[model samples]
Target: MNFLYPGFLFALLAIAIPIVIHLFNFRKFKKVYFSNVQFLKEAKEQNSSRDKLQHLLVLACRILAVMFLVFAFARPYIPLETGADPDKGNLISVYIDNSYSMETVNKEGNLLDEAKRKAKEIANAYQLNDQFQLLTNDFEGKHQRKLNKEAFIQMLEELKISPASRTMQQVVNRLQQEGDSRKNHLVYLLSDFQQNFVGTEKIKSDSSIRYSFISLKANALPNIAVDSVWSLSPVHQPKQAEQLVVQLHNYGAEDAADIPLKLTINQQQKAISNLNVPAGKSVKDTLSFGGLEKGWQKGVLSIKDFPITFDDELNFSFRVNSEMKVLTISGDPTQQFLKSLFAADPYFKLREMAEANINYSTFPEYSLIVLNGLKQPSSGLAQQLKSYVQNGGSLVIFPDLDAGAAVYTPFLTALSLPVVQELKTGKPVSSSIELKDPLFKDVFDQIPANMDLPIVNRYFSYLERNTAGKESILQLPLSQSLFARYPAGAGKIYLSASTLRPEDGNLSRHPVFVPLLFKVAFSSAKEQPMYYTAGKDDLLEQQKTSVSANQSLVLKSTDGTEIIPEIRQTPGKTLLYIADQLKKPGFYDLKRTDSVLAVLAFNDNRRESDMRYARDQNLKDLFAGQQISVHNSEKDALSLNIEAKNSSIELWKLCLILAVVFLAIEILLIRFFNKTKNIQKP
Candidate 1:
């Protein structure tokens, strides 16, 4: 229908030259053999016609050869049916859904193995040089894997189901960018087809895309899991030992049968609690480990039998500093709030003595100094408090709200606090705080109405203007009281500006009262103890430090006896645990020779049960509604969250082979036809 080179058309006009020669009549022949002359003369006209026709056949062959040569140079390709955007090439992308739903058990098998089998089959079907990239939900830095058949299959074999979760929105976005299906993209998704991964409407794709689903397995396994667990050192006593509470949820719809759960601490079995958790509910289990030493502690909770596990066991660890010593030097006998709120908790020690009776040199051992309404401190007291704060001590003040302007100006100013102004505000409004202050960040969401929390009932004076750096909080409803404060370099300080008494409506009686104070005035200032067991996120920061790329370090205990740390640095300054062989709970002596550099503790959070596979379609939940596919089925196995893509060799290479084979056939046919004709002539 089309000609690439129209110039070849001129060859037809050249055929006319033969016609012109014939019409001119320029030929003559001599008579030889009189007997044939009669036949020759009669056939002459017919022979002339036949000769011209023979010449035309040869011309037609030459014209056709030239036309084919030009057509090959132009190069043509026919378009195929339209669909998702034409893939970068002829890529049929298969996104396997290895989510937890694949964990279901049937007579055939689990869905994950089925997905893997299908991937291998697909990989085998594709050419040996095609490209493929696999995608999964458990994404780390290296999430993409593009390989030919063998390597791609190997990677799929290495994939294991993960307890971690991901979303379908993420999977779809990644697949669109990473898949190599440029030509005929056959997007195959194999999955259990959980409710979370299916959609009512067809997803939008470019012209050449088609989707196929392989619905595999489903099982309604009843599972109860310890979904989450949190352990917080009380804001009030950061260094003290306390109980850990775990939250358990039965993901199933009905009441959970009584399950026996055990708690283990440092290899010490604590308690075995059996309780029936109501269906679709959560229950909190508390584990109390008594009198733990300062540093890291780890605990574990295990249930004997469970259908689904990914979340059945939990790991929790926390660090505790040394005991908190508070030196409360106060002349006022009304130390009722401090005496009752802290010392009575039995976790803290209050060395309460009159201000004049205290020894100044003993300040180094205390974690906090409570200056209760003491307007002036001796120069020695000032020096002691100053040094204590420099070493990270907590300080709390009960300033005299009624004191005169110059009453404690010099002492306060030394801590970067402003001088007070007398008669600045006559009547301060009784109101709630405008905003929950950071010192009170924990209680910000816990505001309760109708709880008659006292306003800072009264203020005799106000801090001088422009003295606000970090020293003010809780603005007055009518601008009077400096309700709370934290002066720099003086450690953490909270000033009530009013007395804690019932006549002031006793706001301290509320549940938010003590915790807020503890978090603000002391929580953030907790100091690291001399020993620490390594945690999930642990690091050491030092200046100008080095060891032969690999070397050991040591640490000593209080008496300079225990030397711990039998570690040799590998490559970086960081060390990671590659195996589960954990050290027993005890003080460790680290050493390189007799020189002691640090003391350490060894403790591990036990892994109660080895069951890791999730029994649900968490992968579908993770990806939201991405299509997933699976092939071979296993009766039972953990859910696989990472789906592998089908891989095959390059299509262009196959196309080249076809062209080569066709050329060989064309040459063989020409040779055979000529040879056969010669044989027939014989």
Candidate 2:
């Protein structure tokens, strides 16, 4: 036990005043004439003994009353913890969870409102001069500094539900960064403590910092969320058919039936359907739509979910190009197979160039580049093409089979393709095609037992040292790769063994040539993601763009709000770092001055959709070795518990109550005892 104000103990000397009064007899006795002196003497003896006992009891009560009153002024309490003297000032950090899940309601009302109230109570429990820090999911820069009691309460009132969500370890790391080492640290986290919030990993904490977890409860709600949406086609063309896969999740115990799903593009209804989702499981459905114009298309996939609607709607954006550019650099300009194939469709803009007159600077302008029969490929061209392919540009290589091994060795090895080992002059027929590959998964409607595969009169066999990422699209009789695809960094390489010359092979004239090249060209569009999570994705990648010293890119929303993101230039791409700049779930246009460069969509993180909270034991297990305590908001007195853990268990009120009871006892002994003695004498 210790006293908060030990100097008040000097007032305990007042107890001696009662002792002095008892010792000094200041009352005078009145004598009366009485008959029967002997009987009066016996009565006087018994009454004297009773009078002494009453006087002694009165003195004892007076002493105890004075002592307890002094103790109450001193303010004694039992210390709970040994570290950190209560005499010194304290630094308190309180984290209030204002995420979307906190919008849940309980018997006491909204959880966010209750959390704010609890935060204010915690602030009031501390001393006036003590410094306090208020933290929330937003993690704003202004919340890093400490504030006084008045300012803390004012800030608490200004908090609102935010789209940002953070895990328990992340919150603790932030608090640890803002703690003052000089003062004792007390950290309080008030949240619903969802299982997702307390991630699977164990929490690392400082032993010196005391942590308190106050778990809030709410009424259970059943929810079905549109988990995700993705496009089946990599490239989008104007007035072409498209398909999108939408995944829905049921987070309740009971299954949901006939949930209406809707798709809208550019504010017009494109497709609609009904779905049935099983309990605690996910279901995927495909929506087919077409007739989109040539520009940026803003798409919204929505479902009608009640009570919890934040994760019901998903926003996405994509571009439908009017034409696809194809660049071809061939050693023989007379080859007209590729030219005739693209000329049949105006959607493909083909530009032909000789190997000696190729412009390396305009490589990024084309989606696909074809190197047709480059007899003696230069090392500089190989290096440039390698960089272009690694930065998400697609390439097709039709090697000049007559060229020596030394000429094509460096080029093939630079692009991580198999090198040409030997040239064979035998007629080998292509045995089979990989119908199950993603390239030809939907291209064939039916397959015959004996398919008329391509025939090769003369070809070059490759020396494949590593087959990690090699996928044989067209195979020869002896399991040899005639046409294969290899994944290099972020792009793909399609390698063919024969050239377009009639003496080489008839693959250029085969029926499978058109669709194979079309699929490869379509897959080269560098499809940016349909959407990005707001707080999770910080970097946005785009094809390289030219920006002058005076020009900058701006991201503008529909409300006219704009932000200039940090721009970083790499070899074949431009990276825009919009760290935490996007908070709302909608479409934002990335523009250079007045012209829109691209449209980007952002959505809230769906981890909060689970709506399942972590148990107290789970939280304890996460921070097993740390000095942590868990309290339920519905059961514990948060302020008193915090106070008791921070400082001590107070005894001043108990001391005051005992003082009043002693004073009442002293009054009874003085008045009632004297009346009884007088009655016995009569």
Tens digits of per-residue lDDT for model 2, 554-634: 999998878789999876678999887777778899999889999999898898888899999998899988777888887
Q: Tell me how candidate 1 scores on lDDT.
A: 0.52
TM-score of each: 0.52, 0.88
Candidate 1, residue 116: Cα displacement in angstroms equals 0.6
Error of 2 at 521 (Å): 1.1
- Provide the overall lDDT of each model, using Cα atoms, as 2-decimal numbers: 0.52, 0.87
Which residue segments of model 1 deviate by more than 4 Å?
A: 1-101, 138-145, 172-216, 231-243, 285-295, 319-322, 327-395, 400-458, 461-493, 499-682
Poorest 10 consecutive residues by lDDT, candidate 1? 673-682
* Model 2 alpha-carbon drift over 4 Å, by segment: 7-66, 81-84, 124-127, 414-418, 427-436, 446-452, 455-457, 464-472, 475-480, 625-629, 636-647, 663-682
On lDDT, the candidate that comes out on top is 2
The CA lDDT at 94 in model 2 is 93
Model 2, residue pairs in steric clash: none
